[model samples]
Target: MSRSPSFSRPPPKQFNTRRPQPVAEVLKRTDAFAALRAGVEQIAALEKDLRQLLPDYLGSGVEPGFIKDGVLALFAAHNALAARLRHLEPRLLSDLQQRGWAVNALRIRVRPQAVKEPPPVKQARMTPVGADALHALSESLAPSPLQAALARMAARHLRNREPKK
Candidate 1:
């Protein structure tokens, strides 16, 4: 009974029986996409080299953004990591230069990981019984700020529950 009725029917004419080409093969066929893929590969290679030159902690926290006009852009996970990277800029620049990289300056930017906030809490409504209980409790208490607050809360709850004309 759970089987789809369409299972007995033939597929529509729009369906293609041929297998699709691999993504890399498809991208390589387009000139623009091929260039973009090449740039991405170059950046990845640069990042790997930079990572090898850095300490474990710094390497893990940093990612190479891009290199343009002799300026290499780097993204750090936090301000502390960025600060550390900035301090090591001179040494890194020299090292990269010595390794035949045409880098002249390092541009470090903070790029923190996005944090997901918890869903908002749903407010609990006071039942008539609960409001009545609060009213009774307020009545029993002597004149005080707490008693007044409880009385106001009870009245508000009961008033809100009343139907309008």
Candidate 2:
């Protein structure tokens, strides 16, 4: 006695059909995720404090970039703006402390914002000399699949050069 031929085949694998959970729900399960989220929220609060006190220091010439240890880095778009920010550092630090920020030191760096311009588009195509060379090569090759392919390519390149009817 033997099993049927169809019974010998392995069963199809099963897949879960449940919907995916939201990112916040997923993050709740991770300790590192919670800590990172808290750090980001703290930075945003510090940024808000800087924005609010900017006028009293150097107008809005400075922007918060990054924070490490007790130092908060600020970016100024020009040398003049950076110099002004340097002069306003003490007052800025004091204002930040008053707002409950733990920032103890400031680093002002000039980050000139370049005027963004679209890259010059280069419209490139096969030059007439190149096309002629390809045509000559195609003609010189012996009949084969490769020769046929080269012939088709040369024909396309020649057609590209012709003015539209």
Candidate 3:
């Protein structure tokens, strides 16, 4: 006699009735959060103004920094760019004022842009002359760890150019 396998009933499905809350309502509900959001918005507006003033020059290296005690800060990717920004402080102040911003002092700070290091390049066969020079230099040196290592490396490079038997 053969027996058949039976399957069990699946669990019941659940439905969520709650809807997402609106951002405006949430901001309105919290005073500190609302103020923080407003400050962020102001910084964004300042960044927009900067882009309008100097388009394509900033790229992703420059950004609007926070304003504290009426001092506005701008971040630049490199010192050169920071210097340029400093030079434009007067213009920046005037432009900010025109755009309805209460400007007191403009500060430019250098913040190096983060970049991924490039992949290491594979070792290529050294030229005969270069290999010969390295070999000679290695031989001229007194026998020691560095000399041995250099000689070994030079031999490897020279051997790399030779056809394997």
Alpha-carbon local distance difference test for all models: 0.86, 0.78, 0.79
Task: Looking at model 3, report the run of 10 residues with the lowest lDDT sum.
Answer: 8-17
Mind giving the per-residue lDDT tens digits that candidate 3 earns over 1-165?
336444544433432236566555556656779777787678778888888886477645688888888888888999988887878789878888788877788888888878879989986778889999999999999999989998998999898889889
Of the pair 1 and 2, which is ahead by TM-score? Answer: 1
Per residue, candidate 1 scores C-alpha lDDT tens digits across 116-159 of 69999967689999999999999999999999999999999999
Order the candidates by lDDT, highest first — what do you get?
1, 3, 2
lDDT at 11, model 1: 47
Best by TM-score: 1
lDDT of 3: 0.79
Off by over 4 Å in 3: 1-32, 117-165
Task: Give the clashing residue pairs of candidate 1, or none.
Answer: none
Clashes of 2: 0
TM-score of 2: 0.46
